[model samples]
Target: MPLLQRWRQAISKMSSASPSRFAVLVFTSIIFLWSLLLTLPISSADGTPTRYLDALFTAVSTICVTGLSTVDMSTHWSPFGNVVIFLGIEVGAIGVLTLASILGSVVTRKLGLRQRLIAASDGNALRLHRGAVSESQAVRLGEIGGMLATVALSLIIIETIIALFILPVFWASDLVTHWWDAVSYSFYYSASAFTNTGFAPNPGGVPEFADNGWFLGCLAAATFLGSLGFPVLFSLVRWARDRSKRPGVHVKLTLAATLVLFVLGALTLWLLESGNSDTFGSRTPIEGLLGGSFLSVMARSGGFSTIDIDAMNDSSLLVLDALMFVGGGSASTAGGIKVTTLAVLFLAAVAEARGSSDLQLFRRRIPHDVLRLAIAVALWGAMVVGVSSILVMSLSGAGMREAIFDTISAFATVGLSTGLTESTTPAAQLVLAVTMWLGRVGTVTMAAAVASSERKQLYRLPEERIIVG
Candidate 1:
């Protein structure tokens, strides 16, 4: 074909494809390219090249911000390799949020009905019914830039502050020989924890400062903020700037869900692991409580843990699984079905049980369509975790519970593990890699439904009564 014909064909194809599909391709290409670079000998420790599958696993996990790794960061990779991984993660995080915002912003943009609906619903910011928006809504590309700048600058500032707060602790611990190295590690961990990427450069995950209340607390603060989603951040920033009256329903719900889950997970972990030999074992009350709280936030998609997750009691692991599966707030760095989704589901169920005609929340009527979307996202996520669990067990010879735990870690992109990730078979690792991608890109909003066409409800069929359960 002629060059003009080829350019026209490319433009036509992109015009027809959904933004989500294009985003997936872009992210996938990023993962693939990063994987190859990571496999280079210069990227590995001891000057030996990394294997294809393991390198691929690391690339996908890092880019997806899921910390499940086939190799230890400190021992397996050189400093060069670490830099590569860091850059990959930064890009991946930006890509995920930026693409999500694109559906919310595109200039000269003609979008399908379904695409617009997704834009309204799948925002990092909760749209509180802005006057029946459709094609009538203005598509301003500048909206994308503003949102991206807000998210990026906020993250940088938060991470910088966190790094400063914890740098003294890191240096005092004498973990690193050089001051510069300590500074680098502090910033890296701060960024990783806040971004919820969970990659630890330390061999034992900063055990030197693990018990330091100040260091852990700083990270906890960063993780909490990062997991609240960009929408929440934007709301806070805007409120600060313009003296906004109140937060939107989405921000309100996200904050509430995040707080409730953090407390719940912390309490549960403390109860379950404070006495256990493997985790929080023989620790003082204060230490145990603090450690539990830290792990709980990590479980909520932060991915950093003070203790060996593998040694925790099965019950604690189960709780972690639930926390990881629920993940964090929508449009946030965290993954899973999202806390708001779970919250909305519970609220809907409560309303239904009370025989309410409409799902009422925060003094507003919750649309049935939004409720269905939540249900669909949750169901799709559960199905993905379920199938991946079965395959992981079959391929890796891991026990059923362990399989499920790891599967949730990958699928939610939570990155917590039971020491099974590294030992798992190649095919199982591939399953997890794919799961991480799906979870990070958003399994529900970014994959199938986003790619699907919109159907119009023009004519209604003859009404018929059907039996209900």
Candidate 2:
């Protein structure tokens, strides 16, 4: 009892001192707990205990919302294990601090300043630091309660609607002979899709529904919506009710970039794989288009793949690498450097080309700090991918393409793989698991969490411009 009290006091100190670190601690604790649960005999389909390594991998993948698995997901786990995964992903898809805040509200009957701060930090990493936020891009503190409600309500409503749409399709298909199985699988699919985890409960995985475009469409739609983050969803709901109000710059940029990437990725995949007999060559034009589009959406952190990824060309693999690395929006279930980060970088490049001094987007001036943050996030993400790719390559004796693809998939939390996940060494799998954890935990948040303190300079140093090509 004393030891438990000490642990609680330590956690409370950490939470009060650094919200980001507390979030990391909370997520890590959850992963460990889930890992222990999964290692139990009941968690396995055969009523035998699962390997600790495999259980740990699944726990990381599940909590990270990254679907890459070292084990056969459909056959290895029992109904109880699947339920554990479903619950884990829901806790994970909604930010850790946000979930805590929701529970705290339920227990206490109101959100205090600390709860709001922690929840806001979950939504925006800038809030984790002790300094002023550069811009008003993050949801305001007053709005955190509403945002928390939206997170819970949207997840339930959206997944329910998606499950309803998918239930009829499952009934019409011969995939599940039993109505009870269909009903269970319907909700499973909805949760998986809406959370962007892409873990199919059935044996065959997504290919079982390949010819069923409606089912695939429902999953794809849910995946896309899940990628759009809670802030955008809240703004979208408001805009829906009042047509006069437009979304903020962040929303506009996220939506526009997400749409553009989707279209571009879909077209690129369609063009590249159209002639590959293993992928899209035999399919009808519409079917190929659907396949391309679905894969593209999956690349944005969805993790579901209808077709075999190993059969695609190197060009297509590279395209997927880029898409996965860019990933979904900020504060979303989807991971990676985020679409907004990519947008900022591209906009910065364009501004430099046009000889502009300000980083302007949607008629708003983005502060220099936002660009700095974006650059830091991109560089940090690149470093993680690069180092992990090298490690995976060295440890697994895998080719550059396979190692890089799987590493990026893990790092971006996208879960789309080129058949390297299962064949790799346990050590390599562990590395990828860490990559997934890091990816799901925002790069900025991790940086702040690890740093001793946010340094404040009292004096300005003389600056000089350096020559560059």
Candidate 3:
């Protein structure tokens, strides 16, 4: 074939492929390209060529917005390297297919029908033909452009406000003596917190300001907003402007579940660790409460930590594992199976208990397929975490507690650690990196990618009831 013909054919094939697969390809390409950039001598602080494994690990972590690192992120990289990390997380923070939508609009000068479907599918998996969405849960095709704009605007405005919140805190603290240093730290924390990537530019990380309740509060607030997801934020903005317009079912569920989880996690942690000298027991009751609250927020995919992960009791670690796995809202920078999935599962259990046939919530009937998708996502997330945890333990000889904690952290993109990741073998690091990638790409998207070529069946199957569990 002629070169032009071949190029056209290639483009056509890719365009015809599943959007989920295309998203995976884009993520992989970004990781590879960033890996190469990070491996350059200029990326290192001492002008040495960094190991490809470490570079690749950092690239995956940064691109996945997972804060786990194999090296000292604060001092290992030069100024150029830091910039690369910053931009990489920001790019990754925008959610994969959403970024594609923005780029598509830029390249095509407008969003075609197909492009809108891709963006809509990013926010609403129901758009992928998996199932029907309730009116409240669906984003109309015509509204995609506006939704995209909301995403961009929310990120900028929220991050800027968060940075302003952090700027004065940094200035009051002894950490920085110069104006630029305070500004840089403030903005870095802003991006990191909002992106839910817990990379600190300083050596000691956020713990340096451990006593600064105001700073921790700001970080927690930024993370909570990020975890709310773009769709919820868009709905919130609309509702705020017009009080008569109530938020959608999705927005309600996400907010309600998140608030519930945050409060429960905080109380559970405080109750469990308040007596331990290492985590919160050494502090006053109020101080302990604050620390527990901060840790709880981090567990919701914020990735920032003020308390010591190693000193916490094993029971506390188990609680964190559950919180991290549940993670944040759908279509958000936060990872894991997502709060919406958990909410659906919980509702399904309630309906089953009540002998109700329909999965009802907020006076709306959630389709059976949405339940199936939720179950599939949860199972797939578990499968990934289970398999990766086993591999990590086998390769690193880490204790079950340590291995599982780090693995869940990677799979959830939570970024909490038992201090095992940095000390693990390269093979284990590779496994965790893959976990981060899977977590960030999402289990539902991965499933859709794998089964993208499946066709619909015209005939209905005979209904047979299976025995109850």
TM-score of 3: 0.95
Give the lowest summed-lDDT range of ten residues in model 1.
133-142
* Clash count list over all predictions: 0, 0, 0
lDDT of 1 by residue, 1-469 (tens): 8886676456435534554555566577779999999999999998989999999999999888888999988789888998998887676555453543343335224443433433433452223233333321112222434455676797788888999998887788756899988888988898788878888887778565676788888878888888887767776776677774356677778889989999999888999887797678689878888898999898888888877788988899899999999998876778888998899899998998999878886787766656766787888899889988999998988998889999999988888888889888899999989888878876644433532433667998999999997
Candidate 2, 177-241: lDDT as tens digits: 99998898999999998888989888898998788888899999999999999988987887788
Q: Candidate 3 — what's its lDDT? A: 0.86
- The most accurate candidate by TM-score is 3
- TM-score per candidate: 0.89, 0.94, 0.95
Off by over 4 Å in 1: 1-16, 95-131, 134-143, 442-453, 464-469
Off by over 4 Å in 3: 1-13, 130-135, 447-455
Compose the digit string of candidate 3's lDDT tens values, residues 1-469: 8886676455445644667776777778899999999999999999998999999999999988889999999899998899999999888888887766565555555687767877877777767674344455535677788788888887789889999988998888777889988998888889999989999998899989899888899999999999989888877877788887688788889999999999999999999998999889999999998888999999989888877798899999999999999999888889989999999999999999999999998888887777877888899999999999999999999999999999999999888899999999999999999999989886748545433434679999999999978
lDDT of each: 0.76, 0.86, 0.86
